[model samples]
Target: MVGTSEDLHRLFSFYWFLEAESRNTRSREWAEYFTLIRTQIDLFTMDKFDEELVTQSREAARSKPLKFWSRYRISGGALA
Candidate 1:
């Protein structure tokens, strides 16, 4: 599945809450069960694209004249 890392983290957080609530019960045996499910799930994020494109854009901006750098804005890890 594809989603932002924040969403994925939130999903795991919910699982943790469920585990915590069931602590001391037979259900506790399923603690972190999502971890096992995650092992079989393929997840993808735009982190690599942002790291490569945005980082390079920022570096290139640093080398440009101040006027050029100021002409464009970097928003959401993208050149805008």
Candidate 2:
């Protein structure tokens, strides 16, 4: 479902509403992709993200024709 940056952002935008539904987003690949996007989107929307930060991230988010940053891998830490 999420193949490009625009796709990712849309998924991220729909994020909170999706979470409220308790529905799986069909594919694990897309789901993981959206998770990262969600974090970025959340940061962008949040006051702490800042204008400068948002500007940089927005540019990055637009520039990268991300073919799914989801290799089923996160910057490892604890599993939830």
Candidate 3:
């Protein structure tokens, strides 16, 4: 289980990467892998980590506009 904010941040980043990859590839295998990872993350947060910290880390990862833009380029700067 993750024990610190840094670890949570790393996990969230990985989660984001997996999710993005699953979307970009449109593969069932990647989608399943992302779902498994998400389940593990949820279990860890519920069983061993602080809820607030997990929430904050998830929010931080989701709110990174630069990361989003770099990973996915949309026409006319629209969101993906």
Candidate 4:
């Protein structure tokens, strides 16, 4: 399992669509999503993606409740 509320599995919670995409086990979709994250992450550069990275991103997001923009990293970090 990913984790509980305390842990909150930020990767899954924040990247809920990714979790769904993974659960569906669609490699093409995951690849597209992975590519999106790699090419478009604004704050930091990432060569690879994993649960830890996802969680860290989510945590960073939580620190600022007032931020208006959506940080959802979709295909090539495109706006959805």
Compare the candidates by TM-score and give the number of the best one: 3
Candidate 4 residue-wise lDDT, 1-80, digit = tens: 33333333343344444433444544776757755653454223233345565556556545532222334434445543
Q: Scored by CA lDDT, what does every candidate get?
A: 0.38, 0.46, 0.67, 0.44
The all-Cα superposition gives candidate 4 an RMSD in Å to the true structure of: 10.7
Which stretches of model 1 miss by more than 4 angstroms? 24-80
By TM-score rank, best first, the candidates go 3, 2, 1, 4
1-80 in candidate 3: lDDT tens per residue?
A: 52877667766766676666667655687678878888898787767877788899877766652454346522233435
Error of 2 at 19 (Å): 3.2
Better of 3 and 4 by lDDT: 3
Q: Could you tell me which residue pairs clash in candidate 2?
A: none
| TM-score for candidate 4 | 0.24
Error (Å) of candidate 3 at residue 50 is 1.3
Model 2 lDDT per residue over 1-80, tens place: 21444544444435543342234455666666666666766665555534554455445544442334322223332222
Name the better of 2 and 3 by lDDT: 3
Error of 1 at 61 (Å): 35
Candidate 3's displacement at residue 19, Å, is 1.1
Model 3 C-alpha RMSD to native: 5.5
Give candidate 1's error at residue 77 in angstroms.
40
